[model samples]
Target: MSRSEWQKSTFSGASNECVEVRVVDGTVELRESDAGDIVVRTTPPKFAKFLQGIKAGEFDHLTT
Candidate 1:
C-alpha cells in the first residue's frame, strides 16, 4: 500500500503506540504502530458491525 493510503487515528496525537487503518478495494486493513508487521484485514460490513459494537460498549470488559 502507498503511504498516502494509510490513515492514523486522530486520538493518536504524537503517540508511538497508535492504531492505523487503510482501505483498499472494499477491504479494510488495520495495524498497530508498535507492531507494523502485523495486520488485520476485514470486510467493510464486518468492520462497521465491530465499530457499532464498540460504540455500544460490547468490548468494555476487555479493557477492564
Candidate 2:
C-alpha cells in the first residue's frame, strides 16, 4: 500500500548488497540498493510467485 519510499527487504539485513522494494501505481517495484538506478516492475501476484519460487529453491542454481 505504501508507495515510493524504498525499504530494504528483511532477508537482506546488514548486508552491503540488499534488495529494496516499493509499490507504485499498484505495481511492485524492486531494485538493488547498490544499483538504485535500475528497477524491475511487476504485478503483486507475480511478485508473490517469484518469492515463492525463491523459497522453493527454484532459483538455487543461480546462487550456488
Candidate 3:
C-alpha cells in the first residue's frame, strides 16, 4: 500500500498535539501527531459511527 498523507484538524491551529487522519486502502487511519508511529485503522462505517458518537458526546467523559 502507498503511504497516506495524514491531515490534522483545521482547528488544530499550529499545535503539534492533535489527532491526524487519513484514508488508506478504504480504511480510515488515525494517529496522534505527537505519536505518529502508532495508528488505528477502522472501516468507513465504523468511522462514521465513531464520528456520530463524538457528535453525541458519548466520549465526553474522557475530557472531564
Candidate 4:
C-alpha cells in the first residue's frame, strides 16, 4: 500500500497529531503522520485484542 493513501484520523481535529493509520491487505499500518516515512504494521487480530482491552478497561490504572 502506498503511504500517500493513508488518511489522518478525523478525531485529530485542530491538533498537530502524531499518528496516522491505514488498513490494507488485512493488516493495519501505523505511522507518525508528521514525521513521515516511519511505520509499524500489525495484524487485524492483534489490533482487535488491543481494542478489546480498551473496552474492558484493562488499562484504566494507566490513566490515573
Candidate 5:
C-alpha cells in the first residue's frame, strides 16, 4: 500500500534529531531522522492518545 508523506514538526527546523511521522496501511509510523532504519508503529487512536499526553506535559520531564 502507498504511504503518506513523512512529516516533521516545523519546530525541528534543520535538526536531524527530530522525529518524523507518517501513516501507512491504517497504522501510524514514527522514526527518528538520524536513524532512518528504526521505526515505531502504533494505531491512529493510540497515536492520538500519545499526542494528547505529550501536549498535557506527561513527557516534559524527559525533555529536561
Candidate 6:
C-alpha cells in the first residue's frame, strides 16, 4: 500500500508529526508524517513484540 493511503493514528496528538502504518503481506509498514510516500516495513511478529514491550513500559524512555 502507498504511504498516501495509510491512515493517521486516532491517538495522535494535535501536532501533525505522527506516523502512519499499515499491514501488508504479514509485514507492518511505517512512515513519518513528513516522510511523504516513503515507507519502512518490518515483520508483523517483530512489530507485535515491540508493541508489547512498549505497553509493558520497556520503551518508557521514549516518553521521557
User: Quick one: best lDDT, which candidate?
Assistant: 5
In terms of TM-score, how similar is model 6 to the real structure?
Answer: 0.69
| RMSD for each of the candidates | 2.0, 2.2, 1.1, 2.8, 0.8, 3.0
Every candidate's lDDT: 0.86, 0.90, 0.94, 0.78, 0.97, 0.79
- For residue 12, give model 1's deviation from the true position in Å: 1.2
TM-score of 1: 0.86
Better of 1 and 2 by lDDT: 2
Ten residues in sequence with the least summed lDDT for candidate 2: 1-10
Among all windows of ten consecutive residues in candidate 1, which has the lowest summed lDDT? 1-10
Off by over 4 Å in 1: 1-4
User: Which candidate would rank higher by lDDT, 4 or 5?
Assistant: 5
Best by TM-score: 5
| Model 3 bad stretches (over 4 Å) | none
List the candidate 2 regions with Cα displacement exceeding 4 Å.
Answer: none
* Alpha-carbon deviation at 6 in model 2, angstroms: 0.8
Query: Candidate 3 has what TM-score?
Result: 0.91
Please tell me which model should have the higher TM-score, number 5 or number 6: 5
Query: What's the TM-score of each model vs. the native?
Result: 0.86, 0.84, 0.91, 0.62, 0.93, 0.69
10: Cα error in model 6, Å = 0.7
Per-residue lDDT of 10-61 in model 3, one digit per residue for the tens? 9999999999999988999999999999999999999999999999999999
Prediction 6 global C-alpha lDDT = 0.79
Candidate 3: clashing pairs of residues: none
Sort all candidates by TM-score, best to worst. Answer: 5, 3, 1, 2, 6, 4
